[model samples]
Target chain A: MKVMRETIVSTARELFRSKGYAGASMNDLADAVGLKKSSLYVRFPNKEALVPAVLDLTLQETFGQRDSASGQWDDEFVEVIEFIATTLTDRGRCVGLHLAYGTSDETPIAKHAVRAFFQAHRDHLSSILSRAMPVDVARDIATDTLARLEGATAFVAIFGEKDAMKRAVRLSIEEAKNAAAAKSLSSR
Target chain B: MKVMRETIVSTARELFRSKGYAGASMNDLADAVGLKKSSLYVRFPNKEALVPAVLDLTLQETFGQRDSASGQWDDEFVEVIEFIATTLTDRGRCVGLHLAYGTSDETPIAKHAVRAFFQAHRDHLSSILSRAMPVDVARDIATDTLARLEGATAFVAIFGEKDAMKRAVRLSIEEAKNAAAAKSLSSR
Candidate 1:
């Protein structure tokens, strides 16, 4: 039963990633899962209901269970940014970002899930940045970096320019390093 | 008749912005436009056909017919970034970007329209930045700045952080100024 449920959630994630929320129908999910519409509904009451599960799974798969205690801030930040850039620009689509933008206030649960994922990402980035700069500076840079990465993903999807993400990642890392170096220089 | 057509296109743009490409159906558009499905088809042929026209109108409305002849690169760049940030984050949605992300390879015409819009934006930014720095440097900065703004829009929409756009705008402007200043110092 657990395996069956996981299969449905994973399949739904792919469908949502490619077709989007409205584009991916319950019938399509059922067909993809090789189950009847009734069976799919029994597992997930509706399309919106599946969103939380799908997003949770996506968050886990994309970010994993890694902690930010690596103590190597630069390397860890690079790893995170690289992972995101690669995943987001891989097939020229970011399922998480796409779904987040597509979600409306009408789907509060889905919106909450989307918010949670982004917040987690932001928090992760802030923690890493704080190692090299003031807490507030870290927080602001983290937010800015995340936003830049998200925007670069959109550019990749729209223009098919994978270098856009590379540029964003490079610029973000350079800025973070410069901030850290500036702090050190000032303290000296 | 032209006014009615304009009304339909504008309404469709709102729907696409709010609900995304897959979410906004032909039936919904017809209902919003107070036209029968057949009537909507008569005007547009199909939902996909409306994408190009809607995008063109959106580009015109969002960007207008401004040329980049302004020698004041810093001010001009700021204006463009501020305008994009305001329009994209207003109401917490960017119709052009949302449509672009939601577009699929199957919709070649729609995809082309999205690419063209972003390319025009990049070109505009590049032209402005070239006045302050070397052309190559200006081009890279323009691409980087635009990605940051685009990413900031998604952050604003997802997290409801209006400050995200403000921060992006400020950072972009600061970076452009710093680059211009550096070039002057080195040349002297």
Candidate 2:
């Protein structure tokens, strides 16, 4: 039963990514899961309930560990950008990020999920940035970097174009590498 | 009647900024405007219609001029950052930018408005940045700069705190200035 529920949620996450929260109907969800509509309701009372479940799953999958412990901030920055590009480019990912800002005024669930996502992202980026710069500067740089990524994500989500955003991501990675290199030179 | 319609749109813009499109009810809008809800509908068929009108007004007021004829790219960059800071921090602004990303999946109207907004913004910034660097480089810098600003705006919109985003704006301005100065030095 637990495995079935997990399967349902993972599938629903994909639906939400491709079709969006409002676009993905319960009927579609049930059809994807091969479950009767009534059985789907027995699990999730409404679409809203299903949405946060999908959010949780995406967050878990996308934000695991840095994994590239090359001990180089520049290398990690590039890896992080690569991860972001993959997630943003995937048609069926970052649904939570979309809905968090998209439906924030109307839905507490969305607002809560988005808030948690930003906080977690902020903390993670700040910690990573602190390795090369002062804590305060790192915090600012982290905020700036994440803002660029999210901005690019939002741009693609709105317009379905990746070229401009991809260019922005590349420019950001270059800037981070330069900053790190400059810091090392100054210290030397 | 036209004046009244304009007044309603401007007021609705404020409500949307403070409360978000989903949060601002017709009653709240009517109460703010000193009119009955029925009369409000006479001007705007529904809330969705009202939102785009507000977006038009904001774009007009905020982006009317690049007036920094001083021919200094650094001055213009600071002015642009200042403009963004004012727009994001204003108690009743940037609602369209937020809603564009937030309602993009569900509403074609939102998607259209956001796409136009981003395209216009990119054109405007690229034009300004071209004064400092080659056209291609200017376009990339413009894209990166706007993404950073939008991301910071989204961060503040979600978290209800402006400090991190504000810091990002400051840092971005400094970077732009330094970049422009470096380019000028190379050309010299």
Candidate 3:
């Protein structure tokens, strides 16, 4: 049942990515997963319940990359930064969550997930920033940096190409490095 | 009639920000500015046409800010870097281009404006990078920087607060400045 459930959710996510929420349908999701519409209901009570789960998986996977790096800059903090940047980029490409959060406040599921995601983002960045900068500075930078990254992704999704997206990531990471260094300098 | 037409588009932009694209309608737009539906049509062909014009105006204002910055940092290429960061920080606060452009990808109006935006972005960033770093590195950084900003913005829109967004921007700009400085040193 769990394997079947995962299949349904993953299929729905793929549909949502390729087609906007309005463009996709429960029937389509069911067809994509090789299940009857009724069977899909067995796993997913409805489109609303199912869509968030699909997106949640993607968000978790994208942010989850923090633990998986190996290279010259093996510091845990550096890896965290890299993971965050990649997560943002990946959201656009893989899940389109960056693009599809909502059409408005009425979108409760998207709103809930987005709010939760930001909360996690704030906590994660706060931890990193506190280590490298004053608490206030860290929090400010964290809020602004995350907001900028989100905006950038939205832009790239609408108008930017692959190369442009990649460039944004590189510069952002470099910025994090500079911030860390500057904090050390000022504190010393 | 043209004045009324422009008024409708202009007012719609504001409503879109607070009310969101999906939330507002032609009726609400008309009512907001004290006009009837038929009169509103004199200026805007439909909900769609009005959206683009309004978007253009907002984007124009944003780019306008870039043009008016202190002359000390007004060099064209350098300004593009500044533009990327600025756009990331407050795009949602604006009411035109981003709203229509970011809302959905199907609109032809958004398509043209966004394409033009990206083209200018590439040209400006390319020139600046060529001047400061090896062509490849410069190009890579420009694209990377844009992506990070976009990604960060997506994160903010989803999450609401923006600690991460602020940090990323501050850090990214500093890094870009340093990279430019280093390139100048090497040239000397």
**Evaluated with DockQ, which candidate comes out highest?**
1
Q: Per-residue alpha-carbon lDDT of model 2 for A1-188, expressed as tens digits?
A: 33288888898877766555555678888888887777887778777777778777766775675563457776676677677676777662366545554454566776687677767766766676668766776666666667777777756766676775676677666656666677789999
Best by TM-score: 1
Q: Score the docking of each candidate (DockQ).
A: 0.71, 0.39, 0.30
Please give, for residues B1-188, the per-residue lDDT of candidate 1 as tens digits. Answer: 33388899999988998898988988898889777777887678778878888878877875686665744778788888888888877857877777787777888888788788788778878888888789988877888788888778777788778887888888889888999999999999
Predicted structure 1: lDDT: 0.82
Clashing residue pairs in candidate 2 are A102-B102
Please write out the lDDT profile of model 3 over residues A1-188, one tens digit for every residue.
23477777777776665554554678898778776678777666666676568766766765666643333331654555556556545645334442243334666776576566566766766666666667776666566555445545555555544454344445445655677788779877
From the highest lDDT down, the ranking of the candidates is 1, 2, 3
Off by over 4 Å in 3: A1-3, A18-47, A59-104, A121-156, A164-188, B1-3, B15-28, B34-41, B64-70, B74-106, B118-169
Position B45, candidate 1: lDDT: 72
lDDT of 1 by residue, A98-138 (tens): 78877888888888888888888888888888888998888
Candidate 1 chain B weakest ten by summed lDDT: B62-71
Please state the error at residue B138 of candidate 1 in Å: 2.7
- Cα miss at A86, model 2 (Å)? 1.8
Error of 2 at A180 (Å): 3.8
> Clashes per prediction?
1, 1, 53
Q: Give the lDDT of residue A40 in candidate 1.
A: 77
> RMSD per prediction, one decimal?
2.5, 4.1, 5.6
Lowest lDDT block of 10, candidate 1 chain A: A62-71
